[model samples]
Target: MGYRRLDKHILKAIFHRWIESQSISRIHREEGFDRKTIRSYIELFEAKGLRPGLQMPDEDLDCVLQELLPKNTRGRNKRELLAPYREELLRLVNPDASSGDPESPAERPAEVVRPKTAYLILVEKYRLEVSYETFKLYAREIGLTAQSKRAPTRLESPPGQETQIDYGTVGTLVDHHNGKARRVYAFAAKLSCSRLPFIQFTYTQNKESWMESNIAMVEFYGGVTECLLIDNLKSGVLKPDLWDPQINRGYAEFAEHYRTFIDTARVGKATDKAKIERLIPQARELFRRLKAIHPTWSLDELNRQALLWCRQEYGRAVHGTTGIAPMSLFEEQEQSLLKSLPPVRFEVPRYKPVKVHPDRFFTFEHKRYAMPENCRGQSFIARESGGILRVFDASYRLIRSYPVTEQRVCWLPGDFPKSREALMQGAYPRYLLSRARTLGPAAERLIDGI
Candidate 1:
């Protein structure tokens, strides 16, 4: 330490690997440096921007201010851009074409903007002095705006950006081989810029299938998108709300791991991503076209056929709006996205350790879930995703999960159901047999009396 002066490079290298146990004072004293000089050195290093602190400098008294402070992203102004319609309240006064059309202005759809604007007019009809323009300005200042044309504060996309995703049940078809009608889920993604829609058909909308569909969507385009825009699908959105959306923890982790942000469209607002929203009808058309040509055996078969359709016809065909084919745009945009996505190891939650009490076998939603006897007194995480629920040990290894698909009421082969059953039986009362005999006598007397 004495051999090197307190220069930027030397100090930085020392700072980077500084041991947590060694204090600045100890460093100064052991190195034969004055405290004042050491303080100045630290100040100079901080002035040159060395991330003086990883977090807050002092947390005890500053908690309130930290909590109250707004993040930079929150300051966006989305309301100012659409105030004219809110002020007019046209939909209130005019339920019909009596109000000017919103789109064409001359032939405004009375069903939507007309009624909305009419309502505004009717509500403020008493104030005839305030001209429509003036009133609209007033409304804008007050943070009220038309619902339809409220533009985002800043133009978000730089073109060829964002993709919106959703899952829907297209229809039910009879499974000929199984003699059963099964509903199929259509998982779809539409790139906002290109409006190029990608879809995959799957049996269920569970987490694994949900993520698998997303992976296929990415690979189909030969790239990973910077952001995945999705609707309030249960697999992705934990709580569906516009102002405060909560993405599923597993899905959020997946997004973080992939270095992508998973953005959710406002709840109940399909029009939030208009480009993708408009493709639903067209997707149905494509699905119909595929169905006419192929006989599907299963949802997996349907998905494969769908992909082939994209490569052969859908991706090649010219886009109605852009006048360019989807595949062509995808090629141009693909380069902008990540070449190699982060590894795809999703968290497989084995079990949420819900205590199976000393007496009651833990059951969830009418099904019994098994927990280890050693887990009786401890609280545990409940791992639930991918249509399966299970419990896990502290180290996160799998302990036991809900019974496998189609194996309900029976343990898997080589699983000792008897041992688990024995442990389960221990929780029951010892006097149950005597109580059962007394109940039997009471039942017979009641029957005779009747």
Candidate 2:
């Protein structure tokens, strides 16, 4: 069906509404005209120096609009002109030589060339009369695509051979402690063979959370894989490279404890770790479902729900590619193949070497917290774990402990001592002296001596 044409009166109404600062869509609803037609009319009026505030008679307005208004011009038909060269064009675009190995750049046939060159050939040899633009458009109309040079090969690992880890944002959640919503990230790991997966959620993707999640994942699976294929995330890989990837210190310690090697995926290649990489969308969907059930949940509560949902729903379900339930497949074959977990758990805290100031305070998380008096002018290591920030001496013995907070400066009770001279130098010294003198003449004499 064709679009309804707007008359001069309707066109003027729409343009006037637009001139009065009404949106094109709003005018379209009120004036019963398409937005395209509305834009054309407004553009026509502007082209003739006729603004909204300017006064013009109906006759003058019609004259200016009629002169500037666009006419319905139909383009010439080129179907018959190019019909004879359709098969030849297809052949030139996708030659047999190129078809043998489409991905091999070295094997690209000379006849398989650009559209412009093909158009020139048709003009010179076949005496074609169509313009290059029309030819290019028609070329796209047929099924034709540029050949690719790189042919990617699929890689698979044996059972208990490799596991891939990746972090994905699981939307926002409320931190029950602070009563504020913040973005949460999910650390996911999937076995390459059976596709069994494990996930943990955290507020931060820092070194502490990353290492904690890795430990949690291994514990959940009850075994460790020989190799870990992780993405080039800053928490895990300090510097990403095709060879000799620099792993973070904490992550390296965790790997050593688990007796596994860390192999990072190639740069710009998500498919290198496709097992866990493919689980992000699934994880997102699971998070959405959990959110609908419990719209507002703490980070821990959300993760608990995620764990139950994964086991009952995704784990027991039949796999799309392997045609077997992931849990069943994992239990029957991959379970025994995986290496045994360590006897003791790995605890890696957020560590920083800081020099204690003269005031017996150390800077942590961009904030200052009080330390022991003996730690003055000495270098100590600060560690944060389990919501408790602690300072250790050179021998790693815990010297001080304080509750973690986001405050700029925190002072413990009785940290700073008070003295008579220090108090007398205050702004309220006169009032303090008057109150002291009320006790006795001895107080007055002492205050006067000071």
User: Which stretches in model 2 have alpha-carbon errors above 4 Å?
Assistant: 1-154, 353-450
Question: Distance from true position, residue 186, model 1, in Å?
Answer: 1.4
Decoy 2 TM-score against native: 0.49
- Candidate 1 per-residue C-alpha lDDT over 1-450 given as tens digits, one digit per residue, 9 for 90 to 100: 354444444444334323233567776666665667656655554654544344334343144233323244422233332344443343332324234555576544322322323323333443344445654554455433444654332223544467778877665655766878777667878776655668787668887678767777776765556788888887888798767787775677677766678788877776676666555544554444445334455556776767776665667899766688877876776446544565654454322336565533465544655454455556555666677776666665666666445434423334335444444457233334434456798765554454
Instruction: Output the lDDT of residue 248, model 2.
Output: 83
Q: Using Cα atoms with residue i matched to residue i, what is each candidate's TM-score against the true structure? A: 0.47, 0.49
Give the per-residue lDDT of model 2 (tens digit) for 1-450.
357765667766776786688888899788777677778777777877878778788888788767664576546487457767666566555665233454566444333444555566667666667887777667767655455444344477888899889999867776889988788788888888888888777889988889989998888888999999999999999899888998986798789989999999998898898778678756765564455445667668878877775676678999877788878888998889888987888878687888889977779889898765666899988887667888788777888888887666766666655443245336456755777788988897788778
